[model samples]
Target: MQYRWGSAWGGQRLLGTENIEVAIINRGRPLRSVVLEIRGRSPNGLPPVRMFQEIEELPRNREVRFELASYEMPDEIEELNLSIVSSTAVE
Candidate 1:
């Protein structure tokens, strides 16, 4: 199955800023749920924060925006994109 992510606001602001709005999409198989883990390392020597979102009953080609507890991805990270389906075991 093919999957990808999209975002509206994908960066940090001054302070007390909100994270980027992201969406997860399954291009091939019919998915039931998805757990997205958003992590980032800051240049200010800040540790990475792992955030998660649960997507339920996702149809093919449909997308869901991830709600991260922390801020958007860092600027120093080597990459920024939707994570591949790590595990998509169907029920």
Candidate 2:
């Protein structure tokens, strides 16, 4: 699985600031309630920001998209990180 920002209109923005977008792909078995941890930092050397999110359900070989907004973030992000915090597979 991988993550990246979406297009201009596809991203989520609050009051035309801080556009955020994410895509999660499931290549293994079916999963339920998948949790994700996202981290990022601005160029000004401010403390990093972390965010957590979950996907209700994800099937094998499928993908999901998410749009997020953060007022604390600037329009351009210098560094960003994404990781799968936890997930459970459905038999």
Candidate 3:
């Protein structure tokens, strides 16, 4: 699995914006649902942030973009980590 920042606006990425966009690519089997765990530290001197998102019916060899918005948006994400908490494989 691979992930990167995504932008809804053409060619204009929101690097330091309130809303964060993440693009996830599925390189393996199809999934009925998947839970992604995200952890990062903000540059605003606040505590580390943790977030989770559940994607449904993701097909193989596909990419999806999810927007993350919380009470505080990190000006810059550091030591960011993404993990798969749970997933249902579609046979």
Q: Give Cα-based local distance difference scores for all models.
A: 0.51, 0.71, 0.74
lDDT pick, better of 1 and 2 = 2
Q: Tell me how far the alpha carbon of residue 49 in candidate 3 is from the true structure, in angstroms, after superposition.
A: 0.7
Per-residue accuracy of model 1 over 2-91 as CA lDDT, tens digit each: 433223354444353444455556676766656555565555665664555577666777765555433344443323344444446465
Better of 2 and 3 by TM-score: 3
- TM-score for each candidate, following the candidate numbering: 0.55, 0.76, 0.77
Per-residue lDDT of 1-91 in model 2, one digit per residue for the tens? Answer: 6566643366453344545677677777888888888887767676777888889997787778886676646544566788888989899
Candidate order by decreasing lDDT: 3, 2, 1
Backbone N/Cα/C clashes per model:
1, 0, 0
Point out where model 3 deviates above 4 Å: 6-15, 70-76
Q: Highest TM-score, which number?
A: 3
lDDT tens digits by residue: candidate 3, 1-91: 8888634453555565546678888898998778989887867777887888898867888888887763455456655678889999998
Consecutive 10-residue window with the lowest summed lDDT within model 2 = 7-16
Q: By summed lDDT, which 10 consecutive residues of candidate 1 come out lowest?
A: 1-10
| Pairs with steric clashes in candidate 3 | none
